[model samples]
Target: MAENQGFIGSIVETVKTVFWALVIAGIFRTLFFQPFWIPSGSMKDTLLIGDFLFVNKMAYGYSYASCPAIRIERIGIDLGPDDFCGWFEDRDGRLFGSEPERGDIVVFRHPVTGRDFIKRLIGLPGDRIQMKDGLLHINDTPVEIEDAGIFAEVMAPQGPLGLRPQCANGAVGEGATCEKEKAIETLPNGVSHSILNIGRRSADNTGVFTVPADQFFFVGDNRDNSTDSRFPQAAGGVGFVDRKDLVGRADRVMFSSAGRSMLAFWTWRSDRYFKALE
Candidate 1:
């Protein structure tokens, strides 16, 4: 009987320990940081499809409750930007936090779809933004762009020929094609980073967009492939992201793998492990 009692006690203790550990972990995630997986090639070489990174919540102070979900029970008077569905008028406000600087990569809740999105901040509130012939223009001054040579891989080709991934060594690989234009773009604030241009697309040339107060303009480094503030929400773009929608800033890549499944250890990209995000 004593032995059985000891075994039961051990099980209970293990359960209690796990429960408390999870609780502590959840608290830490909610307040300090959160892990995010890169599932798309939108960020491209800057951030790969399998990269896992942590967003610093303390960077912009903590939101009321981390903007838990898309739908929130309206607890107070409705705020403006009425087009956003399931938006929290009261709980949407951010707590103590600094404003996002230009060239910083930000993660936020998409106003129209309520889905989370990560993109680079290009235009701040009241900044004029436009794209002309595949180049970024801010406040009517053109940003500098320097060609960085070719990056040999075109992912998710629009045509039906499937993939034709190119390697730097003139070798062809399956499920990949290397035929992209890479360039280094310098923001007005002197923050320089790499951008990929996969030929001119519809968003390459757009009219002037004057960002409104308490809002921001964001674009992806993958200029032609991204659907960002360059397009309006009505047209399946993010439109102007509200300040209240800001989540946190991504700082670094904790780990990365090449394939869809992390369990595929052979596909692990050791070089990308603990890689710092520029």
Candidate 2:
């Protein structure tokens, strides 16, 4: 009976600890820092294929509830049929000091499915955004580009997600579909940054779209490889996101990984960690 009582006491303590730990995390993630993982190369060669990142939930503002579309969790509840009611209730509204600015790297909930997405802000309300021949234009003005040298491939030495460094023969299976070009982009505000253009095949390179009030346009640096505001994915609509869908601006690159290969640890580059996004 004594031994049994000891085991039960340990189990009870463990459960209580776990419960409180989760409670604290829920409070933090809901109103403070939230973690995110990159699962695709859609944002490469900037974000790469396997970068684990933390999205600042409070960078735009803190919340005690949830964004409307996602509401993946409410307070501390996991999303489920029974949790839907809470999702709509007690939504943690924004605590922003100001609206998101142009050129701010942002994390936003996909308007189509309420999923989170990180992209560069390119257009704002009352702006005319058009893609011409693989170039971005805003308000009938073309975004200027200055030639920058090719981006050197950086190697990732270690991470839970093993990514091999970029190489001539790196396992980017769809290499044929990607094109790399180096350029310095200057937005209207003179916010300039180096950009890698994947190819000139982006579907966005043809038409004009007017950003609606309280909406913004965004794109990935990988151009053709990104399915951003260009395609009509059933899960996410094509082009433009409302201010409400935007969660927070991407402040920095945090860290990037090569890909899924253990032999490539030597390929890791230490210089790129925590680099500013733009």
Candidate 3:
């Protein structure tokens, strides 16, 4: 009887340990940092398609309680089944957290779909943004950009979703190749990054966009391919994202793997491990 009781005690201790471990981990992820995987190449060359990174929640400052709620919903928990828990809760402007810089790579909840999105902050509150002949203009002044050269990618016939439009122009008799013009762009704040231009794409030209107070304007490094602040929410693009929708800033690439499964260790891109984002 004593032996059986000892075995039961061991099981209970193990369960308790695991329960506490999960609780601590959940708290850390919710209040401190969160891991995210790159599933697309929208920010390519800066953040690759398979790069995994941690977003520093403390970068801007502490967000409201809705931040935790958003994390919970991501794990399939239906907290409220109402507007309050749908990642659309209104957070006061006076709430904790500092404003994001003009060129920081930010992850936020999309205002329309409540989905998480990561992009480079182009315009801060009250900044005038525009695009002309594939160039970005801020406050009626053109952002500096220099010709970097060509960026090429291997594509299947079907091709990657957003990359197709650019690839279509660079297809060499068809079989599976794509290319785009690359440029080194400098934001007003002196943050320089790489941008992919797809010749004369539709988003390459647009009217001026005046960022509102308590909101931000963002865009992808892959200029022609990203559906960002340039498009409306109803058009499947993230419109002006509110300050409360901001999540955190991506700090570094922890590891990367091009394989579909984690077991495919051979596909790991070891060179990209621990790469810091600019």
> Highest lDDT among the candidates is held by which one?
3
- Per-residue C-alpha lDDT of model 2 across residues 118-142, encoded as one tens digit per residue: 7788888988888888788998889
Q: What is the C-alpha lDDT of each candidate?
A: 0.77, 0.64, 0.78
lDDT of 2: 0.64
Selected candidate, larger lDDT, 2 vs 3: 3
- List where candidate 1 sits over 4 angstroms from the true fold: 1-11, 64-93, 154-176
TM-score of model number 3: 0.86
In model 1, the clashing pairs are: 152-178, 153-177, 153-178, 154-177, 164-177, 165-176, 165-177, 166-177, 166-178
List RMSD in Å for every model shown.
6.6, 5.5, 3.6
Consecutive 10-residue window with the lowest summed lDDT within model 2? 63-72
What does candidate 1's lDDT look like per residue over 122-240, in tens digits? 99989999999989999999999999997665444321222233233444454466667889999988999898887657898999999999899999987866779999999899999
Task: Indicate the residue-level lDDT of 156 in model 3.
Answer: 34
Each candidate's TM vs. the true structure? 0.82, 0.76, 0.86
Q: Clashing residue pairs, candidate 3?
A: none
